[model samples]
Target: MRSNGGPVIRADIYVRISQDLTGEEQGVARQEESCRQLAADLGMEVRHVWTDNDLSATKKNVVRPDFEAMLASKPEAIICWHTDRLIRVTKDLEKVIELGVNVHAVMAGHLDLSTPAGRAVARTVTAWATYEGEQKAERQKLANQQAAQQGRPYTAGIRPFGYGDDHMTLIADEAAAIVEGAQMILAGESLTAVARKWDEAKLQSPRSKVTGAKGWTLRGVKKVLTSPRYAGMSTYYGEVIGEAQWPPILDPEVHYSVLAILNSPERFSGGKRTGRTPGTLLAGIGGCGYDGCTDTVNGRGYRGVPVYGCKDTHTRTPRSIADDRASKATLARLMFPDFLGQILETQNAQEGQSGAQLQSQAKELRERLDGLAMAYAEGAISLSQMTAGSQAIQKKLETIESELVSTAGIPPLDPVKGVAGLIEGWPTLPLPTRRAWVDFCCIVTLNPAKGRHLTSMSVDDHITIEWRDVSD
Candidate 1:
């Protein structure tokens, strides 16, 4: 066919999406379908089509292959799903219009490019979208700011190792590791050396995987030392603030020292992967099972496997056979709990409010508790909050009804009295308190096999059995 007796060719359709238009949703497919339908309706021959998904609209000018090809081929017309779909910012759009590219939009009925009305519609739509994007960004900024102010992690990406999301915080395991790492780094171990130790010891990344395409990388170590998250603080768009929502990762001193290291010239500033095996978690924690034999390490494995053993067993072949058993027994006795008895004592203690005054103060406490619960349910709260709220509020009752019975005349665990206070002073409390006697208690973990040898037992882990720390 010929146009004005010169030449006529089919229109080539081009579709593009910078972000939020791929597998995330149907934006890409929808754009293509709409473009094809509009081209059919207009009776323009659909010559060829091209799609650029996740390709940024603001990328270098003239970098788009589809755009370059269409221009070079000089089709009779270039049709698009919408103006914004073709050109994001004004500069890019101007280049298209100047190149005689025709635009179309599926929505807005007839936002077209064949006339001035269409161009006006496109401009208004672009303006509104730009405004909406700005507003969303502003809201995110405010939300992140508030999170930081409350001592919560705010960064949306991977957690900077040794910290949680509520900003600068450290959980139990990470905190322990952090304490040790701080000591080592401060002792003048290179950052690269530290990283190597971590790798060798299977100190894996919480955010990333252990192997394959998503495996952990050395970047995790750098994050651990440089991030303020471990310090129980957060930053919003680079503005540091306090009161983080997550539990701190390291002691305050260690956290700040790490930050200082990051800023200082003498920081552990190397990533030495070559010629060195990474570290392990048990490096400093393991020793002989008995105090008398500290020479041989309680090896991590047995029969060529990782296992703890008496350091002096190889040298002092005639040592007492019961030493290992004795060591373990000591550790166990130190950690085990008489669950029911402990619970009874805890319930009887009137630590804070008395059982008699419990009703008077319960309303306010419950309200606060409810708010925390709601936030956690809505995903507005962090993991720490969710866990805390889930386990907190040991007990709640509307009215004291003259008393909450405890173990045989023990004071009631009241909304008023502290659990400890109630239990400690139980003998004098009202007899009705005896009715509140309860049997439930947490089971503590203890290693009966290894016993409590100072040289063999790991801190916290081996002593958790039947151990009652919090009574109320």
Candidate 2:
């Protein structure tokens, strides 16, 4: 039997709001209540209220999760506060109309968006909204450009290891920790160790709260070194902004120095050295003091001892050094007590240019570049000749410069420190230093006492020695 008032269709209610609406504490609630009241007035059966908060509503026919589910559930109709409320965007409104759901907005007239005029109104609203948002964004961009040109402090967001919100500004606490942390790393603290230091020091992340995140790691350290913010610079979408508002955590120079060290495999990838001679300075350096030879060693010496020798004895110069017993004896002799005096002499005689000198050489190369330019201007050189000549000079200069830089100088380990004062001071120095000594010092050879093997048994069992140097 039909009721006195007549049959009522169910109404599925949906609501959506963007991040901007987060400020409006009661917007969603009010929208929901008004729709419910409207549905009741129209004699509709109210079903579920579905909502998406903090979502953009400007898109035409946005496929909101709740809205789609309600449609699929085949509700009898959708009830809303107004027509624009039913569909902020055209596509969404068209979708419901196409699905044949009776959409009724209490304030606005009923719409069978199925017709051309109704569809036209929905599209016009969508287009207007999109245009408005775009124009707003453009205005904001222009304002920012004006601010930057005026040297005002700009900001964007606070990064895990960087600062600034609108522009070149840094949060003080985060900046301090990062700079101190870089120094700690430079001072020989492990990255893991540095992270712990921060935690122990009671510093917090830029988040203003500290309990949630893990401390620094190698990955974290790498990122901090690479960030330009600590060096008093800011970049936005690859555009450089100069003279930032926030104080720089690190002097740009010091920051770059740390960057160099971190990027250098020679500085960081050594892992840890082991044994009496902890480092293999010549580990990657090849022995080429001899003709047509390339050899290397464990820095491991005669027998179980540490010595650098010719790998070519086996591969390149077959049977170069022979007899195990004789080979061991030669190495032991080379480092004999008598060699102590020679070692002292070697240390005292060492001489080379400083990093500054190497830098000066680089300057010379730049001057050479200037010279070429001048020569070209004077018509003293052909274009092709100039190009080839400049390239060749550059290549050779780079090779020498690298060699000078790498082999700069190291005073051979002091023999006096070894025997007279205390223990094997060799253990005190880092392995990298030790490795460098054997790598660049004089050559050692286990050639036949007179270039002859004792017998055929000794032929395949020959021994070899290597030469390292110390120099500029």
Task: Determine the backbone clash count of candidate 2.
Answer: 25
What is the C-alpha lDDT profile of model 2 across 200-311, one tens digit per residue? 8776554433234555545556666656556766544323345555667788767655655554324432222332333444434433245555544334454443444445
- Off by more than 4 A, model 1: 1-82, 108-111, 155-183, 197-220, 267-472
Q: Name the lDDT of candidate 2.
A: 0.54
Estimate the overall C-alpha local distance difference test score of candidate 1: 0.51
Which 10 successive residues of model 2 have the least lDDT summed? Answer: 314-323
C-alpha TM-score for every candidate: 0.43, 0.44
- Report model 1's TM-score to 2 decimal places: 0.43
